[model samples]
Target: MDSAVLSGRSLSRHFSVKGAAAPVEAVRDVTLEVAPGALTALVGPDGAGKTTLLRMAAGLLAPSGGSLSVLGVDVAARPQEVQDRISYMPQRFGLYEDLSVQENMDLYADLHGVPADVRRERFERLLHMTDLARFTSRPAGKLSGGMKQKLGLACTLVRLPELLLLDEPTVGVDPLSRRELWEIVRQLVEQERLSVIVSTSYMDEAERCQQVFVMHQGRLLAAGAPADLRSRAEGLSFTAVPRTGNSARTLQARLLDARDVVVDAVPEGGHVRFIRRPDASDGAVAQLLDGLPVNPVPARLEDGFMMLLRAAPPPPTLPTLPTSPTLPASPALTPPAASKPARAAGPAGGADSMIEVRDLVRKFGDFTAVASTSFSVARGEIFGLLGPNGAGKTTTFRMLCGLLPASSGFLQVAGVNLRHARAQARAKVGYVSQKFALYGNLTVRENLDFFGGAYGLYGQRLEQRTSQVLEEFQLGGQEHMPSGQLPGGFKQRLAMATGLLHEPEVLFLDEPTSGADPLARREFWRRITTLSEQGVTVVVTTHFMEEAEYCDRIVIQDAGKVLAIGTPREVRKQADDAGNMEDAFIRIVEQNRNGGAP
Candidate 1:
């Protein structure tokens, strides 16, 4: 019995464009095998060719060289035959937004030629698993990001496919939603014996798979069990805590900026977690983190990821930032409601409160989007708002930024009332949305200049600001590259660079690192801590719960209501679990769902 469901031998894919000098090699010669009933994952950074490889496996993409097969059938030669036995959900699945949930499912079933007798039980089971039974009649467009993803999966599973393919299904979704989606997949794989190949940026997700494939720049770097990869970098990983008065972020920045020796560094639970090169001398490693408390910790999939990335070419070079930076506000960058910077007394206790919300409420007709949410953030603080997608995190942020009106509550930002002095509040803050909001057709330099000019910078001021951001984000040579063509990690950096061009008092990042790789995440947060230390208030929303550990304080929301608010340690103590952010988060959310509070 040859139990392998998918196998590729010297498989390669390439694209030729009219204007390009070199043809794009999306997938190079690669050999791999996925067994039946196995959960296999392809993990890598943005533009690493995960999607292209998945397409080739699905038969939607024809390999320019070599050969591939699915379930013993040649995919390239008999795509339609192979397609009939598999389900593939691309990165951006095409679902009819105007149709009702039930309608969309029915349409997909018709396309797949699923018989009526099989539809009854299949539809019911899918609706129950996805928690969409109650929303069957609701329009697909009205669903939240998480619910939409679930619906997309349900549609793909309308018929029993021998294999399933998911491409970053949880990219922009929150932690809770991600858990639910994975649960649905795991159930099918265990019970129905369906083989699966999922491409993802999350190391945790990749660890859940039975086998993992590491991809980088269209090449397969490594393939093995999660534990095997973790063992490859075991002794090189460490968790270090800075001495009193020196923050973990400061140490992380120091280690990361020394890219010549260190591979990666990130802030985790008040400690600097990093990976040192295996070949570095004892003196070199000791001098890197002098006067720090260091301890060896067990390596994980992420450590292996960094190890492989270090062996490859270094990522784009980010410019060193100064201890202090000056950001001036201009009429173009400020929101329409906020025309001037707020210089009055801080919200509550002078500078203690940079942001304040009291009894906030937002209603959409008969349903409430946010309910009696109250929290305050002090200057120089990194505050996090986390919850399942569509749990009102965005709504709360919009009200605070004065972009959306709160039905009932008082909101203040930077010592100014958001409702009354919206423009002033806008002038005091910078925002980076979840989606890439820059001009797709414009080059990186063009986008930066446009944003700078909007911030009221002109002539030399614009030039200086653009140059600073370019260097700070390590985006020097990207000036002429089209913003749309840049990789996912680079796109995120560009968006952040544009937001920081004007330098407001506070920064708001909505899932800023959603699809970025491990190294990119470390680099992103290092700059954030530096900004917070410089007296700037920071408020961010994220799906990655581990990131919550880096914040001074965090709030969790669900069903449009506040569930818990405290430091990472405090929240974990309440859970009585293993103390990891994921464990704590699951405990808190589950307790809340069961009508209990921590």
Candidate 2:
């Protein structure tokens, strides 16, 4: 520990708020160490103190109580010296939008006080490493999400220091971009012998690190190598194939609701992988599975992470289904008997098509954002639209929601012709954009009232609906609080509540769980499953490839073109039975990019 690159002993941070009863303890009695020339990850949910610890190490924020040393210097007493020896890239890396890529790099270099003689070689190497050399003259605003992240990274490296700190570097980017950014960081650690400490929401990303520190509720839950953590769930992980009548999502929801016998559940490869409570007996686990065939699967880092989180009680802020029986049938979520059949190439069962598109196209000046795409969604199906950044998924989503006009093609939603009745179609669908669009200054109820009025509800009807969702989404107690002051999970719940106030037949979600932790994501999907079961069609877009398994069918697009479309299993088969959805997605996109098909 004496040779540690950075270390903290009993680090803690607390903040006082104006109307709060006590100080918000952002970090409490925590201790950790980062090794030199190796990758280390701080894994946690929102409000878990990861950012606070990083800021303390960077000398941007002082710890309330503790001793911290960086590069053998006491950071608390000599902040300037430690600040000069480390590079910190926060969640939002500052970049001038109007500046060219080269100009942005120069700005960082100038700020870092790099010598003129060292600029040329460093800039060239950084740009090439980021694969942004060709776009050096392009304005930063014109870059895609992934490209902008790469540029941000390049700027962060204009002058390499003793250590690197990255906070959720891959949060909003696509799978392809996430992979590329990790490659750049790995090369820096392996070749340049750099010391790194990154905080991330992706469990798979944490698995890539040599050591991981898991934090929750401002405290360190555990810290060790990824393999050592995986061992914690060794005997408790299992995958269950749903019975003939149920979908993987439906079955996963049932398991998740069984809190006494199940700790976590997620859809994967046409099956539901779940973790049984350590104290639950074999009979209890079987009853929760509802007679489905089950088999043991190797425990993943995520399983261990989930198990660690279960030690802490979940926030009672999200809705849950009744726990009466195995996969308890909620009157709101169970599809009717007549339309219960699901098809691989078309809508679920023989249900009527709720969304249809043919030869759809969107053009931005001379560029085609969407090129000749076709698809259909059943009345109660969960359909996923997936693609890399700038692949036109948003353009396609906008057209479906009636927010943007398609350049050419036929479009229909809820039996309303988009071209002729775009306004009417809009009334039948609820839309949640990638970012939270509600007014943060307003209280939860006030924001809901404003959006409800905009949706044409008023008087008693608006009041009734507002109260209904307040209880349904578990936001009743916090109704009078300012929306901005709510926690990350509560904010997301409010967003979804607003979208559902009008009772739209179809719901549109764009990367809804982009940076949410695994626990929050599980709860979010559980609610979505309930909505679909209630005959409301759900159309979603996400960068989490594993989430694609929840969709009845998915369409993958690249370069504004559809590359593949089918159920998760069918899509995997198209990729020659790739191990998982992520692998299948990468294979399909890489094959198409390389002028071939899998």
Candidate 3:
């Protein structure tokens, strides 16, 4: 038998909510094993207890019941022993924001008691491997989202631990960074016989693992290779593209409602793909797709997950809140208009230019986050900025939004120079940050109202705008709930609602759908399309390459440079031999990493 690096028997964790009567079972009766040198994935949705299970395996959290052992040490009884042999990266690992990249590495190395000579060698290799040498002196907090993720990974890798436990390390990281992180893992597993247990929400990432464990509501639903889980979904999947007036969102919702027959439904590009319940008959599936263009297709991991979730009855729905008296019944809320001056022409046809950026640069002392990059965003288009973590997408975004001033370059928003007119440029664009930016203590309605007022809206107009936005974003019923108390999906909707409260000509979303479910993503895109119909130009970044298909055009960046730019179809063509976007992305990034043209 293969060596069991870590094993858990009937492991469970419970947390007591401050006000709740009963303890919340974060993880329940979970049993699993991580074999030496094997890549095992713990997959689940938000709050599904993936983190809890990983923590227990890492000896960071003691299980309320059952037992766990790391290597030969009993974690429950010998946590320090397990800690000495394993590297555990919690969901929010402490990365010193004030320290420079090299300083952070040195600090972690010192903490791990790595010898000075060995630490020097390891740090040098890591800096080169992560391509962070150029930014060695830059503060960790000052780095872009992707850069921070890379730094965090680098800090953990300073010491050669026998086991590595990472809890959603790539949650908000970009594709390039994600690929690099995985490559490092693959190499470590092969070279050192390292045992790794990582929790991730991305199915593609999970598919790369040798073994996958599916968890939901603190229970293990399935465990096997990706192929094995996919095989179980055979003969149940069918694909259908949008026809006539039916949108993907409409089709998905309709299919989801048929829960008894259709086990799962997901939107891939322009089509709705689904899996039928095992007990569902052929005729029943046919009936479900009656009048729609449907074809048999292979099943995917996501399809399998949806099938499993639908097969088992759903957990009880949370109780609804009382209606708010402040919100009026009629007309609803209408978001404030854009604060910036309106452009002479609508997005469809501007003076041949929508956003012109020339020789744009953002630098921090000796470190340059974005090194003289240039790009343009067309009017009435969905433009995507793609790259690995720390690729400078966020830096470029901040400069575009006038949140961060460019060190040098000619930057224009809606044909107006931002350096000369910062407020005007900012007013013309709506930005949804990667992090939750809304007031957590404020109700959804209050958050929207505050944002709208910031844009100079007032009185009944502000109230009307808030109502309209709430309804448009599907948060009409949850208006009174505090934004902080909402789930991942609802929180995303609330943030988006606030961003769009003022009708800006351009919408900027930084990983807006990060940590969101497939269903929520589809819904969010539907709203994006609705806004696009009204001629709102969208500039966004996402870790999910599949979501890139929704964009009219995309730009891939690396090492502070634009690598590729084209329509989704065009970019896929660039992959040529690689086939899909995921494959193309890997190919492009690997070539760039190896010092070739991206």
Better of 1 and 2 by lDDT: 2
Q: Tell me the deviation in Å of residue 160 in model 3.
A: 3.8
Across 1-598, the per-residue lDDT of candidate 3 in tens digits comes to 2368877789889876432346778898988877778899888765678877877777778889998888878898988888888888876779999999989999999898999989888888778777899999999987876678778888998998888888888878767667777887787788777888888878877888899898877888899998888787888888877675445545765676686787666655556777778887778877887778788898777777666665654553223355643323324122234343332222223365678888998898887888878777766567788887777887898888888888999989887798889898877788898786988888777888888888777898788777776665556566676777666777887788778776787889999988765545655775675565456778898888877766767788877888777765567677664545667777777777888855
User: Which rank order by TM-score, best down to worst?
Assistant: 2, 1, 3
Q: Give the TM-score of candidate 3.
A: 0.78
Q: What's the count of clashing pairs in each model shown?
A: 9, 3, 13
TM-score per prediction, in order, is 0.89, 0.93, 0.78
Per-residue lDDT tens digits for candidate 1, residues 501-570, read 7877778998898878776787678777667756667799998877887787788898899988876667
Model 1: colliding residue pairs: 330-455, 332-454, 333-454, 337-422, 337-423, 338-422, 338-423, 338-424, 339-423
Output the better candidate (1/3) by TM-score: 1
Candidate 2's TM-score reads 0.93
Candidate 1: where are CA atoms >4 Å away?
1-3, 16-20, 241-247, 258-262, 281-294, 315-349
Q: RMSD in angstroms, all models? A: 5.7, 4.6, 5.4
**Candidate 2 collision pairs:** 333-533, 341-349, 342-349
Candidates in descending lDDT order:
2, 1, 3
